[model samples]
Target: MTLREFMVQRQPALCERWLDLLLADYGEETAANWRRERDPFANPIGHTFTTEAPRLVEAVSGDGKFDTVAAAALEAIIKIRSVQELAPSRAIAFVYMLRDVIRGELGTELARGAHATALATVDRRIERLALLAFDVYVRCREQVFRLRQDELKRSVASLLRRWHGSELPEPASEEVVHLSPPPNHAVRR
Candidate 1:
C-alpha cells in the first residue's frame, strides 16, 4: 500500500495514540481529568486534543500544507500551552511526539523500507509544524507580556496620582520620563 493510504487507514488509531501521549505531558491528575471529561467547555485542552489531532494527522497524511484547518488546530493547541506552566520547549514538544506516534503505529510496516522516502517526508512535515508551533507560542507570550505591562503601567499611574494628590500632566508622545539629579547630588558623568 502507498504511504498515504497506510497513514489514512491508521489515522484514527494514530490520532488516539497521539492524544494519549499529549495528555500524558499534563501529569497524572490533570491527564485523568482530561481523559474522563469530554465537555469542551469544561475540558478545553482535552477537547482541543481530540478535535485537532485528527486535523493534524489528516494534514500530515495528505498534501502537507499549513492550510487553514491545520493552522487553526496548531494555534489552538499552542495557545493553551503558551498560557500554562510549560516552558517553550515543553509546549512545542508535542508536535515532535506525533512522529513517535506515527512510527509506533506503523511498527513493522515502517521497517519494510518501501515507505522510507515517504516516511522521511512526513518527518520533515512534522518538523515544520513544530516550527510553526514555536512561532505561535512566542506570539502568544509576547501578547501576554504586553498585557501585563499595560496593567502595571495603569497601577503605577494610579499610585502616582494618589501620592501627589492631584492629576499629573500626561507625558507627550514618545517622551521619556527623567528624574532630576536628586536635588544637588553631583552628576557623575
Candidate 2:
C-alpha cells in the first residue's frame, strides 16, 4: 500500500495500542498524568514539514531561476505528509522529494554528477532522526507492556495468597507470562 494509505489505516490503531501499553506500564493515575503532560496530538508528525520545507528551499534558492522548481519539489513532500499522521514512510518520501528538488535546481548534467554529493549530508541526518524517533516508540511500548504484566501478576498473587491463607509469593519470583517474538526463521527475509 502507499505510505499515505498505510498511515491512515494504521495510525489510530497504533496510537491506541501504544496508549494501552502505557496504561499497563504506569498505573491509571500515573498514565493519566503522562497523557496530560505529553500531549501527543499537539506535535503530530505529518503537519510538521509542509510549509516549513518549502520556505527553507525558497530562502536558500533566493530569486534564481531554479527557485520555483526547487520550491515545488519541497511542496510535494509536504503534500504527501498532509494526508495523514507523520510516519517513517512519509519521512522516506520527503527525503526523496528533497533529492529531486536539489537535482532539478542544479540542472540535468550537473545534477547527475553532483546530486549524491550534494545531498549525502542531509540524507544521513534525516535517516538518523527517523531511526531515533522509531527507537523511542519501541522503548516506550516495551516499558508499558512490562508495567501491565507486573500489575496483573501482583493482583493474581494477592488473590492466591488470600485463598491459601498464606503469605503471597514475591512479585519478582512470580511466573509472569508474555507474548514471545516470532522466531528468526519464521520471518521473511
Query: Which structure among the candidates has the greatest lDDT?
Result: 1
lDDT of each: 0.78, 0.40
Q: List RMSD in Å for every model shown.
A: 12.1, 16.7
Per-residue error (Å), model 2, residue 141: 2.9
lDDT tens digits by residue: candidate 1, 29-125 = 9988997899999988888888989999888788755476676788788888888898899988999999999889998788867699899889888
Tell me the tens digit of each residue's lDDT in model 2 across 83-155. 3344545433433343344444334434345434434544444343334333333433454566676778776
- Worst ten-residue run, lDDT, model 2? 180-189
Model 1 accuracy (lDDT, Cα): 0.78
Model 2: residues >4 Å from true position, as ranges?
Answer: 1-118, 156-189
Give candidate 1's TM-score: 0.78
If scored against the real structure, what TM-score would every candidate get?
Answer: 0.78, 0.29
Residue pairs with colliding backbones in model 2 are 24-148, 46-86
- Candidate 2 matches the true fold with a TM-score of 0.29
Clash totals in order: 0, 2
